[model samples]
Target: KRVGEDLNRHVTTDGSKAEWDAQDVGLMNQVNFDESTMPIPLCSCTGVPRQCYKWGNGGWQSSCCTTTLSLYPLPQMPNKRHARMGGRKMSGSVFTRLLSRLAADGHDLSIPLDLKNYWAKHGTNRYITIK
Candidate 1:
């Protein structure tokens, strides 16, 4: 959720680059088959240690990662039209950066391209203009 929302990696506090390993992300980060998200601490920031990335959240998950639904407040299966996410035009956006990292990690992105909308309907948003 944080990644899709463009938040920093290992981000303890919201909207900051502060990297922390403590399980203090509150209730928002945890989910079933979390390994699917590959939440490894791939950082080499000034204060972070290299060895720290070797472990944490490690285990074997038999759960079908994609079949698993979302987290908290309201959990539901992905929409029926659920398909891979793609960018209209690639740039330095967080979405692209995440995709880049995934690709760099040797992920097979075969035919993983599609055009899509660029709008959002955030939960905190209340003013949806009606036509």
Candidate 2:
């Protein structure tokens, strides 16, 4: 009865209850599911996907990881001194020198390649110091 009352209260552009009722029916029909798709087979033990099997006190047990439908908010980390230093601008020569030092310490050369490409295109007028 409450649902019917709420539906009747929903006003449309035609300002008629009959038009709103028809529109609601049309919208609901458009959201109908396809008959061709097959449903996923659920694990008999946990009712979720069976990822692994483990031996318990009796015999082999089916282990499954269940997913939550609720949304969980993550806590933010405090900004550190290194993050603040990352915003400092440096000359192209100084940037190249730092890259060379990193390379000598057995670091990956992809960082230098990316910096070289950026320096060639932008000419390093405002290059941020990459930590």
TM-score (C-alpha) between model 2 and the true structure: 0.19
> What TM-scores do the predictions have?
0.22, 0.19
Cα lDDT tens digits, model 1, 15-59, are: 333432332433343322233453422212222322111111332
**Candidate 2 structure quality by residue, lDDT tens digits, 11-122:** 5556343552353332222321112441211233233233222122211211221121111111122354322111112243333443444445575544212221112121
User: lDDT values of the candidates?
Assistant: 0.27, 0.28
User: After aligning candidate 1 to the native by TM-score, how far in Å is the CA of 110 from where it should be?
Assistant: 2.4
Q: Native-vs-model 1 lDDT?
A: 0.27
Give lDDT for model 2: 0.28
Instruction: Give the CA lDDT, 0 to 100, for residue 59 in model 1.
Output: 20
lDDT measured at residue 3 in model 1 versus the true structure, 0 to 100: 47
The 10-residue segment of model 2 with minimum total lDDT is 65-74
